[model samples]
Target chain A: MPDTPAIEVRGVTRLFESRKGFLFREHTRTEALRGVDLAVRSGSIYGLLGPNGAGKTTLVKILSTLLLPTSGSARVLGHDVVEDSEWLRPRIGLVLGGERGLYNRVSARDNLRYFADLYGIPGGEREARIAAVLERVDLLAAADRRVEEFSRGMKQKLHIARGILHRPEVLFLDEPTIGLDPKSARETRKLVRSLVSDGVTILLTTHYMFEAEELCPEIAVLSKGRIVAHDTVAGLRQLVGGDRTLEAEAYGFDDREVDAVRRLPGVSKVVSEEYGPRTRLTLRLRSLQTSPDDVAAALPGHSELSVRERRTSLEDVYLDLVEEEAH
Target chain B: MTTVEVPRISRSRATSASLRLSFLMFMADPQWLIPSMIAPVVFGLVAFELFRGSGPYYLTYAILGAGMMSMWGQTLYGSGWAIGQDREFGTLEPTVQSPTPYVYVVLGRVLWNVISGLIGGGIVYLVVLAAAGSPPAVPDPVGFVVLFVFVMLTLASVGILFSAAWVYTRYSGFIQNVGEFAFYVGTGCMFPVVLLPFWTNPIALIFPPTWALDALRYLAIPGYVGFGWGFWPDIAGAVATTAIYVAIASTVFKRVELHVLSKGDLSDY
Candidate 1:
């Protein structure tokens, strides 16, 4: 059972029904999750990445037993989240997006203590448990201060403190470092790594690709309620697939010129992205035989002023995959 | 540092903690506490002076009325904001997800309001005595104490029932306001329901708090004549009706909680 995935989600679909008008209303259905299936390995930091409205939070909520899936199953620590929510709740902790999840009127210490009690942390151990988590999140000094008086990052730290206060077997963190300063973000990531090392399974959702790459060994990228890519950092990077991409930032880059570049024998794909007045042309090449010089020459023919090559990155691949899903 | 085996939450401990925390929140916030406490008492004292020469029992009525309104206001605010404040703070979902029973937590939250009503009502009693220049005669001292206790319980039950209904509806904050107003006028807390049309008396009779106020007037005040009924009959109605209300509220609270868990979120109020 220890080797079993900490979280096992199968065919989880949550369809929302919202009425359009007050009267003479028609029900509009929005599929927040369309049969999402995922399994987060024990002791691993699993990154769930996606753009806004990609159902990342929906999945997190479902797994945490905060929202029941309209259809399908989600389990945490081998207990069904719906049927055994009470049993599962004690073993898992969740830090939902933003600072919406804390008692702003209470001190950070009280918030942590309150959540600790909610998790059923033994009374005898609560004080130290609270202190440990606060220390871990670098919030011990401000522990007695009211959370509303704290900065966004400090509140986030308090959120983290609450999440980890019970020493849960599984943790759901939806963009935990979203509003944090870089230094605090880095510290939080360090705390996350420590938690994983201590055998805690973490499910993290973030817009930061590099942070995901740095923290998560395995990631599942969601797009419009489905997983578009689920693999290791290198494996996902390979979705770009041996094709060398040369990005050119140009002033007059247009479709006609992009087509001209695509016509080049070695050019496999040409993607022109608008950047206000300028356009960044990404040339996906099958071989080194595809010359940037030839591509620039082809582009300059259509009034594009200067052209230079830029390396392909994970951000580029993530955007490309999301774009592909959008179409 | 070495970590010990994590322990399961103690329900008693959690409940006690939750109770203490909410009570602190109730007392600490000066903005709400000051206005809610002072406004009614001061207003009632001023009104009592004007009604002194005209209404024979206005002195006793003013004190009891102010106390009753404060109880209604505090109870409404207590039950009204329990879940809405959580959602506003974004703690509702997490709260539902927590291993502790939501009922225990909710009851803990409302516990402060019940205590507040008792203390506030007592304070109003003393203040009215000071303003009236004499303590009102208690016809039945033991009966009065017993009746007052029942009134507090009745008010608490009604507040809880209101909260249970509140969670199921989309109108959260508005529910409390409307409820407080209805209870104030309908319960005969201000003016006697006998002054209202005979039909409205039936509506007021539907609630135990109305019976509580009627019973209190008969048990405590010397000159108070209550609906031509004996104090025991009125007390019986208050106890029986409040029991029914509490049972209904408990059932409704469970249903509403399930809906909240499945559908997610409650009204904004």
Candidate 2:
């Protein structure tokens, strides 16, 4: 137990009893987290990606000591989440919902100082720490204004600043760039990378595949209260194999012909769609069993024959895993 | 994220300063200040006009009763409303997440209510005396001071307990109002407990506001027979009863807080 990882979640489960309706007597205990195990290294950027209602937020809350698991145990920095919460509090900084958690009435400076006081930092030291973090977030000029007046980008930046102000060993950033412009999003990602450089272990949950691929050394795909896959984006994408996914735009493509092509010897998976005045087809295959030529040969008298093996991306892997699990 | 090296201080200083800041923040809110300051003075005038012709004792009773009314009203409402709003706005989670104990936050609210209540009550007393053009025969100053201490401790201690109503209801403003109605009605703020029918004192005695009102009335009036008891005995009883209420309220608040944490609604505000 003493040698538990920085974050060690062991078969944690949460079952919440929710009433279906007020008039009818129906109460259902929905399992938000199944018995799941996850371990984050001491100083690594760990990304958790999932669709809505995947229990990612529930897992984050449990790790932060805000919620207790029903059956399993989680520890942070060698401290049990439930029993040693006091020792854990000072060691973790959490930005649960980005800018939404900020106090709009107070200036950024005042907000940081207030939290510092709560963390038992003295007046002078708290001021110095706030100043340093504000500069890092590039909000030193706007530090005096109330947070309500801050632009969405500025608020997001301040959110990062607040989470890092105390220099917590582990920072839980949940959707840190959900509502930022492209430029602001890029800057936020860069700042997160720098935090990783500073030895702050980051546990980030986001839907943006590109951000996770760029920032997270390791990624966990959460779906319906379970981690379907946990590995590098490359590694997970490889689970779908090295087939070059070919999407073609053509007219008058017959559905039966495409289905017949799927049954052909090299074809692995075929997805067909009808767009405005056009029919589109995407096919995946194992490169070893089926060459792009054999599948192309299967389609005859077609106006166009566009064929390429699928180069798997994180998005592709994520969608495939979720869709496969749902079925 | 960098490892911020914050300067360390003595635990005593940190706790004290946090308490002081909590008090300042509590008093700065308008909900506490406006009603607390105005209610006592307004009620004092109404009482003076209604009971002045009867005797100086009734006038003194009006002043003391109004003062106690303002104390409990401001303390409980101020702490309760502020905590409720913070909960609604999702501010309570961060507060709970902080390294400070829950006791410090409650203490801050208690102190704010006590100081503001005293200030509001003092102003009301001066204005009433000036308007009446005469002062009543004062009782023992030492006993008044003791009574004031008991009232402060009692109200401050109960601040968090009453704040539970807001916590449970998720800041339904009407619910908080309903929860505090007992303080206003049973404490003789709306009507004197002594004027109640035979069976009501037992019920009213359950609240410190009732005794707080009685103690203040005994101090401010001539021929100060306090609930048919002498001065020192009345003072002692007030202190003992207030202490008992404070202890019970604190215990209740702790249980409610634990329940809230278990439910995982600490951040639901």
* Model 2 C-alpha lDDT versus the unseen true structure: 0.72
Displacement of residue A124 (Cα, Å) in model 2 is 3.4
- Candidate 2 structure quality by residue, lDDT tens digits, B165-263: 666557546765776776676666645676777587788776665666566666656554536665555557666777775677667666665666666
Q: Model 2: runs farther than 4 Å from truth?
A: A1-4, A19-26, A252-256, A259-268, A285-296, A304-310, B1-33, B36-41, B134-137, B140-146, B190-192, B241-254
Q: Could you give me the TM-score of model 1 versus the true structure?
A: 0.89
lDDT by residue (A114-168, candidate 2, tens digit) is: 6777777666677888999999888999998878799988988887887887788
Q: What residue pairs are clashing in model 2?
A: A243-A309, A243-A310, A244-A309, A244-A310, A245-A309, A245-A310, B87-B269, B90-B269
Error of 1 at B26 (Å): 2.6
DockQ leader: 1
Tell me the whole-model lDDT of each prediction, alpha carbons only.
Answer: 0.77, 0.72
List ranges where model 1 is wrong by over 4 Å.
A20-26, A248-268, A274-279, A285-312, B1-12, B50-59, B191-198, B222-229, B266-269
